[model samples]
Target: MNPLLDERKATVEADHQWIANLEVDERARTGIPLLKVGFNETFGYYISISRAKADQVPANYIRKQTLKNEERYITPELKEREARILTARDDLHKLEYEVFVTLREEVGEQAEAIRHLSRAVAAADVLCGLAELAVYQGYCRPEMVNGRELKIVDGRHPVVEQSLPAGFFVPNSTELGNIEETSPLPDLIILTGPNASGKSCYLRQVGLIQLMAQIGSFVPAKSARLGVCDRIFTRVGAVDDLATGQSTFMVEMNETANILNHATSRSLVLLDEIGRGTATFDGLSIAWAVAEYLAMEIRSRTIFATHYHELNELAGMLPNVANYQVTVKELPDQIIFLHQVQPGGADKSYGIEAGRLAGLPTVVIQRAKQVMGQIEKHSKIAMGLREGL
Candidate 1:
């Protein structure tokens, strides 16, 4: 569309090629195969020759620079070519900017129409992509309702399922609140299990299903009936924000506080390892209090995934709170993660087994087990004393 730009670009390229050709001819004429043509800001296009070949330079090569082991020289022809090349670049830039301004003005005339068409195209692209995903991945349309009920039968993680082979990613079901004649489920689910038993994945799955349903897209489930939520809040994983001068624990508490302050009965909250960055008892205590608050005060649909098995007591105390665990098959030497979330609270986290599977040294693993045993013994005694007191 711009002939001036094309012509200027060709001129620049041809000038550069001329310098390269000049170097090749000079190398052959002077019998210096190591001669190179280069350009720097301080010294415009110059031919570099090693000190050993200083005597071999042609008479027309005027010395421009002297390095530790090389001498740079520029011929009169090369100097003139350099000036043209440099000026042509500046002219090219100015011409390009002028052309750009002209094109931009032309585009600006139809800016409204362009924006309208762009919005339509973008919407169609998104819808087509989602429809394709639904067809290929066997996603089911969710039945959204006005009431506070979320039910999914055999739901899978949208992203994780795709990464695995077909039918490899296990699907799990979730039910909360009452729908029609169905019995009411808990508002808050206390999810506990071993270190790598898919508790976090299950929590994320529920949140994603709810989000996908609300966005008018088919969810990655065999069947689902979801209620529209005002907001979906998540506090997952621990990462210290050093730039903001906040530790991992501080970040966790800040997010938790935000969820508690703003979340309502119509909100969906997904929390994972809420207070594991602090001391064991401190973390457990905070997790317990957070779960209780979400169940009682906020009354939000929550999936609290934590290693604190003690929080399972909330299910016993709170009517709106329930307990779920990612089941595992314990073997003699190791544990197999079932990746199945079922109703019940796990008594053990099996952290040492996880560490062992992660390839910790035998001595370290044994020492960890010993320490764990002692801690459990002391915890039981402490509980007994507290109960008595």
Candidate 2:
């Protein structure tokens, strides 16, 4: 008989009755509380006890099984009845499998409808999750604009801030173009700060905020005004594609070329440490020209984060270029990263101090400071020669 038939109700009720009657309690002859009582193929039914109280078992309790920690036993009554029921169930299993296949195909006929409904339910769950995250993180709804100008108030890097301890991650503000500026092309900000400061975080935050808003989600910011963007281009960290035989510098140039070729005025570009894979002068010159290209030609709202303070000179040279730096406080012995972005370029790169914090040798740090002093003195002397000419 098919298990799905109404006549099989009697059989299911019989199984329930058999299971209910087979119930055992912790008050067994072992005098130790039974931790678990369950059944499986190898162990039909078992009662477990702690090894500490194994000595308390009565002499009549014939040990059917022995583990390192505990013992198992079975009364003759349980084994006899269980064997009769198992023989019948084994025969029923083969017949039941064929019936199950037919029932499954009947259900499979409706799979397309079920799949569509599952998709709808999944989409609802995702929206609910995003809503909960927005509420929990105190994210604000970003305002969308038709033009290319981004403004974020007290924005934070979502992933970085979450990884830090509560209240440890500092927030920063950004603006690509002022609401009152009324310019067609949004100005680009040149972000210069010491190594290990929050310049990269700031650049990433802007891109993420814009992306989140475009997707109809709240952003990680106190408030944000997002400009229309066809695409958000990023040339941030680099990695050599050794399998493809491309060097790190080649990869960097390829990404930079991609941005230069495709980006438009409405694009938001985030560039970090660009042209840094080559020598000093070559890297500086490329970084300088790339910043100029974005500001002068592409006019995309951009954040160009770099150690090359030389690029900061574009702030005065180009109308759409402005300078910003991550604020850090210098102590007698150590520098504290405030993680605050403010207007103007950093006076120095603080590379030696950054190296000191990176666990470099003290002698190397001192030697670097001396070398920096000498470079500055020679720079002034060279300037004197140019003035004399």
lDDT of 1 by residue, 1-389 (tens): 89879999999999988987998899899999999999888888899999999999889999988999999999999999999899999999999999999999999999999999999999999889989999999999999989889899999999999899888899999988645455668999888999978988888899999998887899999999999999999999879999999999999999999999999999999999998999987887788788888888888889999888878777767788889999999889878888998999999999899888889999999999999889887776335434542
For candidate 2, give the lDDT.
Answer: 0.79
Candidate 1 weakest lDDT stretch, 10 residues = 380-389
Model 2 regions more than 4 Å off: 1-96, 177-186, 380-389
Clashes of 2: 0
Q: Write one digit per residue (lDDT tens) for candidate 2, span 1-389.
A: 36354334456457546655544434553456554555778968655555677677655445678789877766555565566557546655755777789889987999999999999999899888879989999999999987666888999888999999989989888888534555532378888888888787888888888888898889889999888789999988879999999999999999999999999888889999998999977897788889888888888888999988767777766778888999899999988888899999886778899899889999999999999999877664323423442
TM-score of each: 0.75, 0.74
lDDT of 1 at 313: 75
Q: Name the top TM-score candidate.
A: 1
Q: How big is the positional error of residue 337 in model 1, measured in Å on the Cα after superposition?
A: 0.9
**TM-score of structure candidate 2:** 0.74
